[model samples]
Target: MNRQTLLGYVYAATGAALFSTKAIFIKLAYMERVDAPLMLALRMATSLPFFLGAVIWVVWKAKRDGKPLPPRRLWISAILAGCLGYYLSSLLDFEGLIYITAQLERLVLYTYPVMVLVIGWMFFGGRITWMSVLGSAVTYAGLLLVFLKALPEGGHDVVIGTVLVLGCALTFAIYQLLAKKFITVMGSLLFTGVALSASAVACIIHYIVVSGGVDFSASHRFYWLAFGCGIFATVLPSFLVNAGLSRVTAQSNAMISSISPIVTISLAVAVLGESFTIFDAIGSAMVIAGIAIFAVADQKRAPAKRETLPVEIEAA
Candidate 1:
């Protein structure tokens, strides 16, 4: 590979690894007696200023280039998309994590690409090939393998957590679908700034409504973890992945991101003391393999179509 391509792969892999740490951070915070709403609020509040600064930078750059800003309607739509993907989806994922292992959560969320394909084929006139179908089936089967093993010990919590994470994956897929046009029009930097800012604001409002006010009584470790989640997992990884996307094809980026689940599982076992069994080994492999197959097939199927930057991957 050329220098630029190698750099892109490094950026993509690094971003994916950072993204994998989000679940670990969330789980760590939960161990500090932090509730989902409070943790989500803190994470987003910490991230808000960075995204707002990005917005300012984007606007200033556009003006310097004599380019007009996107339409007001697009701004509204981008905010709505952000709320769906980050606010609602993240809330569900956080709540779900309370009941499940981070490894399971990451594995489950790994199926979002399949959900994206199915949603597109069903509602957006996108085509699905037999390979895609086979891939999706294999992916779910692997999820079932891991999920079923969790049931006897985890009981109802596993089911609830799986459902919630699945919801997160679905909403995230929808966000990806909707945000494509906005990204195409507004550009990734501007759209991301607007959307993330909107989501952060929504998270703050939700926190106030749910908790009556922002509680700052948490341990220092909690704050540090939240800061790490916001800066490392949320913000830095975003620009890194976007930079990678600029230098590489979307297909290559997607393929490189397959490392995400593995990273999460490793962190879960090492940091959280979660168990990793032979079933987890087999199941995780299947999920990764299935996603790889699906992603390759989906990309080949629409080789001529315009590729939308998968910016949503970094939002996790």
Candidate 2:
């Protein structure tokens, strides 16, 4: 590979690995008795300023280039997309993690691309080849293995958690589909900055309204965890992934990101003392393999049909 390509791989892998740590930090914070809203709020609070800075920078650059500003409608759409993807989807994921292992959560959320494909086919006249179906089936079969294995151990909570995470995946898929146009017009960086900042504000408002006040009474460790989530997991990985995209093909970036769930599984085992059974092993492998197949098929899709669709889902 050329130097740029090599650097792209490094950036993508590092970003994926870092983003994978989000669940571990979240699980640890939960051990300290932090609720989902507060945790989400704190994380958004911590990350808000950086995203705001990005927004300012993008605006300045746009003006410097004599580009017209995005319309109010596009800004609203971006904000809505951010709220759906980061705020709602993340809230569900966080809540689900309370009941399910991080490994399981990651695996379940990994199916969002499949969800996107299905949604596209259903509503947007997108074609579904046999390869996509096979890949999706295999992916779900693997998830079933993991779910069945954990069902006995976690019982009702596992079911509930799985459902919640499913909701997260679905919402995120919708967000990806709907946000494409806004991302195109406003540019990814600007749209992302505006959306994420709006989501952060929404999260803070939700926390205050739900809890009757914003509580910052958590332990120091919780603060550190929040910082890790906000900066390392959320903000840093975003830029790293964007950087990787600049240097590498989207296909290569997707392949590199396949390591994400594996990284999360390893961290959960090491840090959270979660078990890794034969079922978990086989199931995780299947999930990754299935997604790989799906990604390949997606890339092979008609270029015209692919124009309106996003290639990958954003990380939580």
TM-scores of the models, in the order given: 0.97, 0.95
- 55-101 per-residue lDDT for model 1 (tens digits): 99999988999999999999999999999988989888988899999
Model 1, CA-based lDDT: 0.88
- For TM-score, the strongest prediction is 1
lDDT of 2 by residue, 1-316 (tens): 8998799789889888888898999999999975888888889998899889999999998899998999999998888888888888888888898999999999999898899899988986678989989999999999999999999999999999999999999999888888877877888788878878888998889889999875667888988998889988888888888778778767667678899999999999999999999999999999999999888887777331212222233345
Model 2 / residue 58 / CA error / Å: 0.6
Clashing pairs in 1: none
lDDT of each: 0.88, 0.85
The TM-score of candidate 1 is 0.97
Model 1 error, position 293 (Å) = 0.5
